[model samples]
Target: MDSSTTRTKMTVEEIVDALRDKIVVQELAPGVKLREIAVASEFGISRPRVREAFSILEERGLIERTHNQGAVVARQTAGQIEALFDVREVLEALAVRLATQNAPKGTWDVFRERFGPRAIKAIETNDMDYYVEAVNEFRRKTFQEANNEILSQSLDRLYDRTRVLIQRLVLMPGRAAAALEEHRQVIEAMIEGDAVRAEQLKRANIVSARRWFQDFKKFLL
Candidate 1:
C-alpha cells in the first residue's frame, strides 16, 4: 500500500469512527487502556489527532480518561443497561406515536422494503450482528418518519451511547428471532396508522429486549 494513500488526513470525526468501530466490535475490550501514543502510531496519525478522537469518544460515553491510566473503555453495569433500555423504551414509544400521527402516506414503505429481506436473511443465518443492524435501521427509520428534528437528534445521541452494549446483548441466544418478530409487529402497527398500538407495541418490544438483556447479563459482562 502506498504510504500516502494509506495515510489520508484523519479528521476528529474519522478518528472517532475508527475508535467507535473498534469498541463496538469488541476489538478494544472493556477496561482496556487506550493510550494516545499507541493509538496514533497504529493509525499512522499524530498524537494530537488521537487525543482529539479520544475526546469525542469520551463525550459519546464509550471511554473515560483516568489520571494514571490514560483512557479506558467505559463499563456498563446490569442496572445501568436496564435503565438505558427503560429510557430507550419511553423515547421510542414517543417516536412511534409521533411518526404515526405525522407520517406521510407510505412513510414506512422504505423500511418494509429495506428490512423485510434482511430480517429474513438474519433469521435463516442466525446472524446476530446482521439482526442487530437491521433492528437499529428499522428503529432509525421509524424515528425519521416522525419528522421531528429535535427528537431525532436526541435519540441519535442516546443510541450512539448505548449501541455497543445493545449489540452485545442482542447476540445472546434466542434474542435475534424474538427481536425480528418484534420488529414485524412494530411495522404492522405503523402500517395500520394505529398510533396508540404502535406506541404500546414499541414499548413492549423494548421492555422485552431489556428483560432479555437482564437475563443474559452474566454472559455479557
Candidate 2:
C-alpha cells in the first residue's frame, strides 16, 4: 500500500492483492465497474492475468460480475450485515466463554490493561490505531486459547471480509468509546474468572454493535 502496485507489472496474485486493497480502502467504491482491459492497462499486465485476478477476488466476495460490467465492488446490504452479526454474536460469545474457562492464568492480563482508561482517552482524541490494535490482539489471544476447533474455523471464515466494515463501525459517533467500555467489561469478567458473565457481556457487546450498524445504515448502504 505504501508503494503503487497499480502501475507495475504484476502477477495474478499481486493484481488481486492490489485490487483487494483498493476495494477495502474505498478507492474502488461499491458498484463501480472494474473493466478487465482497463485494469490490465493500469497494471501493465495481460488481460488474461487480470481476468484471473478478478476470479480470485470474486471468490473472496470483494467483487462481483454484473450483466454488462465485468466486475464491480460488491455492495453491502443491511440484511447481510444482520445475518453475519447474528451468527458472529453467538460464536464469539461462546469462544470468549470457553477461552475464559480454559486459557492459562494471566492470558488476558495484557488485554485487560489495554482496554482500560487509557484506551478511552485515545478514543476521545479520535485515535483508533491503539484501540483497534488492542482489540485485534485480544481476539487473537482469545481464539488461540479458546481451544475449540469448530469455533475457531467458523469464526475465522466469518471474519475474513469484515475487517473494513469493523473499522468503519468503530469510527461512528460515540461508538469507539462505547465499544472499548463494552470490551473492558468483558475483559474484567474474564479476569475475575467469571465465564458466564464474560459470555453475557460479549454477547451484549455484539448486540450493541449491530444496533449501531442499523442506526447508520443510511450512510453505509
Candidate 3:
C-alpha cells in the first residue's frame, strides 16, 4: 500500500456533475435526501464544497431545497410531468418547425449522418445508455440548427428534469425501437423540408411518450 498521496481539490462544478449523474442514473432516485456532510465525506471534500454543489444542482432543477429538510432530489408528480410535457411539446414542435425551415444547407444531412445511424446501432446492440446519449445529441443539434437561442435556453431548463424520465422511458421493453423509428421519421420530415410534418411528428412523439409515463407512473415517477 502506498502511504503518500497527492490529490487536487474538486471544484463545485465537478461535484455537481457527479451528483447529477447519480440522479440521472436513478442511483439516487427522486426524493432521496442529499446530506452535505455525508456527500462531503464520500467525496473527500469539505461541507462547504458540497453545499455549493447542492446550490448549483438546485438551480438546475435536479434537486430541491427545503427549509427544514435541506436538499432532496427533485420529484415530479404526474401533474408536474404532464405540465412539463405540455410546455415541451409546444417548444419542441416549434424547434422542429424552425429547424426544418432555418437549418443551413447540409445541416440535416450531417445530423442524419452523425446521429441517426448511431441511434439505430445503439438499439441493435441494446445499449440503452448510448441510445440515450444519441437521442440527447440529436436534440442538441436540432435546437442549434433551429437558431433560436431563447427557445433553446427555455427548453434546456426542462431537459435536466425531462431527461431523467426519458432515460426510464427508453429502457422500457420495446420503447427503444419505437423511439428510434419515431425519431427517424421526424428527421426524414426535417430533411425533406416539410416543416408542418416535422413539427407534427415531433409533437406526436413527445405526447406519446408522455402518455406512457402517465400510464406507468407508479413505477416510473
The best candidate by TM-score is 1
Q: Give a tens-digit lDDT track for model 2, residues 143-194.
A: 9889988889778656755667898888889889889989999999998889
Distance from true position, residue 103, model 2, in Å? 2.6
lDDT of each: 0.79, 0.84, 0.83
Q: Residue 200, candidate 3: how far off, in angstroms?
A: 2.2
Model 1 agreement with the true structure over 151-212: per-residue lDDT tens digits: 88778767766777677666777777777777778878888889999899989988998888
RMSD of 3: 3.8
lDDT of 3 by residue, 143-190 (tens): 888899999978887886787788878777777888788888898888
* Model 3 per-residue lDDT at 141: 85
Query: What TM-score does structure 2 among the candidates reach?
Result: 0.79
Better of 1 and 3 by TM-score: 1
Error of 3 at 34 (Å): 1.4
Q: Which stretches of candidate 1 lie over 4 Å from their true place?
A: 1-8, 110-130
Work out the TM-score per prediction. Answer: 0.82, 0.79, 0.79
TM-score of 3: 0.79
